[model samples]
Target: MSGAHAPAVVFDAVTVRYADSPAPALRSASFVVEEGELAVVAGRTGAGKSTLLGAVNGTVPHFTGGHLSGRVTVAGLDTRTHRPRDLADVVGVVRQDPLAGFVTDTVEEELAYTLEQLAVAPTAMRRRVEEVLDVLGIADLRDAPLSDLSGGQQQRVAIGSVLTAGPRVLVLDEPTSALDPAGAEEVLATLSRLVHDLGLTVVVSEHRLERIVGLADHLLLVHDDGTVTDGEPAALLATAPLAPPVVHLGRWAGWDPLPLTVRAARREARDLRTALETSTPPPGPAVPAPPAAAPVLLEGLGISVRHGDVTAVDGIDLGLAGGEVVALMGRNGSGKSSLLWALHGTGPRSAGAVEVRAGDTTVDPSRESPAQRRRHVGLVPQSAGDLLYLATVDAECRQADHEARAPAGTARGHLDRLAPGIPGDRHPRDLSEGQRLALVVAVQLTAAPDVLLLDEPTRGLDYPAKEALTRLLRRLAEDGAAVLVATHDVEFAAGVADRAVVMAGGAVVADGRARDVLCDSPAFAPQVAKVLSPQRLLTVAEVRRAFAAPPSADGARDLGGAGGGAGGSAPYPVLGGRR
Candidate 1:
């Protein structure tokens, strides 16, 4: 068992670069994971986070065709002479792209394939699969067709398959990238369980820090130039200025030794409240909560789509107005995406009302042309870089601006805001996922559309990236943009959206304030909601407002962002609820 503080893995002067490549993905990288500890690895996509993890299981050069040097010892064995299979006794891995490891069509079959390779007895294999599936709460999916499963569900199957092998060290690469809010919650819960119950050495490479921040015993930050900073999660986060907004906000808000959990945030708020008591009372009455915005008004809608003879989203009524962000929730195969497409006129929706009132004109989506609709609506697809085939990031934005009729330089402002150091000559798609998302958004913002739709925008982002995205989207809404995000990230939705709507079987199930909707529905509540308020503020500042030190003499805000980790709070209890 990789017990607390018991070293289980080590790396010495590790360096990797593909054959003939100009620069190495990892340069002299070194780290260690104690037995029974949860280690988190973060960097922008393409920051060599994946390459680093692959090195541990001997996949760096073995599977990726990269040049490798230096020693990579896992569980007391050097990996230089060991193939991935040779390290089978020491490590089990889950990648950001679970499909990378999948070859079977059924969950059980996939698991069995791995077990059989290890020569585990048939009886033990079944028992092991059952226990792991139960741990992941995917027993019901054991016989389900792999192709029929959503990305999140598929990842669970992938993870279950690996866990069945009973490797001492588990390394997951962006393991939660594909999960929806509920599915993400399930996955994080399981990782925590693996660390605490099974006492396995767990190493996870991810972008989103909020999910595992509280559970992490160790944290590593990977810079694009192949530089890394390693330390305790809280210590590293508080000092990493370019880190996620939540961490920044936590440090500034003076969260008393700071906290990584909701309960800790709550306690900090209580402390702030005590400080507030020392201040003089205000002359005027307290301010009310923000006002509710008007509902979107949609006229006739006609949509054409077929999922096995059934329309995903039929002719429906929908519209988006100012000051609102809506979460279009639904199971995979539902028409939520189709409805969004129909609204944007990106796809044909046969026969019905589709009108959007902006300022003077009533834009009828059904009657509009493709180019016309694009000018009024912005969209960030699942694969955001899909439309980017350009030679440079600046070129992508410049073209989009030209198409949108905005000033050619309008894109540069947005681009600079999102990525301060990115040059115009850099290829957009070649950047990391977070960078790609930011670049795409910058390009889209040049159009300044009234309605913006994003599909799974947080798919490959780290905690910092995800939080920045939430803040960015919220700012867009505040600037009078109606943003509709199709996401599985309930926490992101809770943090950024003013409104929430869940779609099921091709229709809207419910719609209301984000807090009311998310808190009331577990399926859509963020993983953090298990321990925090349903209004899980997306930023550390917002979290501080709810849980940090009190307002000043005049009720002024404290903006430094300091301290984290519960020096107090009995224990950050695990929560259980179904969405």
Candidate 2:
């Protein structure tokens, strides 16, 4: 046990290098995380964030076969002297890929697995399992098969399984990447309570800063060169390489002590909102109007999917025109992934007619062979790594090119564009989550199908990688392909999608322009839209463009001089309080 005044975790001149890689993943990184503090690790994808976290529990050197110099001490126990199993009682880790860590068949059983391994008494184990299930709001899924549960449910179960062990320090990588906005909020709230009420130190790595920034007490930034920096969240984020939309907006508006939450941003955005009262944001990219006789690139009629007695998709009719990007969103388990899989023809589909336009003939995708289907429609599933089986990145690319009958380096070209600098010789399993996702995306694009479906494509991507993906998808749309992205990321949707579709209870509940669908819903709105409500501004780039453009001659107002008053009340009711 650590002394009362000792830090929860300490890294002293620590450096870690894998045998395969030429450079160290972490280079002489030094930091300290005090007990009960919530430290968020922020960095670009594959920028050593995971390497830093793995070091906390000795996974870096012990399990990953990496060379570790210096030392990592957690709760007064040196990681060099403690294997993962030895540190299990003091440190609990929930990795980015939850399913990879699951060992049980059911939710309740999974939660009890960790406790059972620790030899806890049956009475205490049952109590701990119940507490974790209830705390994570997953008690209703206690008896559900782990395979039947949605990705978000699996994430909750993963966290619950760790919580049942009752460790003093918790480490999670992209914990809420699979969850909906509300679900992410609940999980973060639970973590906050654990930190404050239980004095549990938390070190988490997440790409979606908006979801976790407000709850973080400290920030650990890992640079591309493997160096690490730590400080207050706001201060570090103000100049960090990437930040949430709200922070971008705060920086754009010159708000001192940049707001980390929508509530704080709203409080500081009063005058700025008044300044933009008369300026309308520039319109989104123009989607060319399809001719009346043009065939829909992809169409689904009366689609119905079921697993046992549960209806995953219930007789839904949908269509996508060529040269369009659609965002499919909803609460976890609301049928988004199910719908995507059904459309792709691989998942369960009891009833549905999915047709894709192939040249002059329209063909049913479900009736086509996997190879034939790839020629017309392609899909990247939520678990992208599952599609990878090759020994190295070069091998995967080579196979993808061969399967698609494309140029030898075609897939590798796409991968470079999406996430540059990933070594070709590294094994797919060794790459970071985002890198693995990028590789799959590149492989799927090798066929260059007319219709593309991506489920949770941005699961592990940072903002820059997402921007690159956005550009790639836009290029695909411009090339007359139809793209459908099933995602929980509202900001990505706002920026990349031309249309938005919301699903509920296995049916399409809402469908319309992305701006209208996203801005109108409090739960689905992006941080910028939430900060500047009633303006329909969805992104920081939009706001920046709006402010940069010269005033129009017809009643347009200058951003700098629109609101003469020093202080003005927000036009809309203050949105919901802090999450």
lDDT for position 199 in model 2: 87
Candidate-wise lDDT, in order: 0.69, 0.83
- For 1-579, candidate 2 gives per-residue lDDT tens digits of 555566899999999998867789999999999999999998887789988999999988898897999989998889888889898988999977678888989999999999899999999999999998777788999999998876667777887888899888999988998889987877788788889987899999998998999999999999878999999999988877678888877877889989999999999988878877777744344333555754589898899998888898999998998877899999988998888878887777888698889888899887888888888888988878999998999999999888889988999998987777788898988887778888888888898889999999888888777776777788898788899999999988988887889998988888887877888888899988899887777777677656777878764533321101111111111100000
Residue 299, model 1: Cα distance from true site in angstroms? 6.2
Query: Considering summed lDDT, which 10 consecutive residues are worst modelled in model 1?
Result: 570-579
Cα lDDT of model 1 by residue, 253-341, tens digit: 55547667655665666544454343323212122234476445333344445556677775555556666667777666667777776
Q: Candidate 2, residue 137: CA error in Å?
A: 5.8
Clash totals for all models, in order? Answer: 44, 0
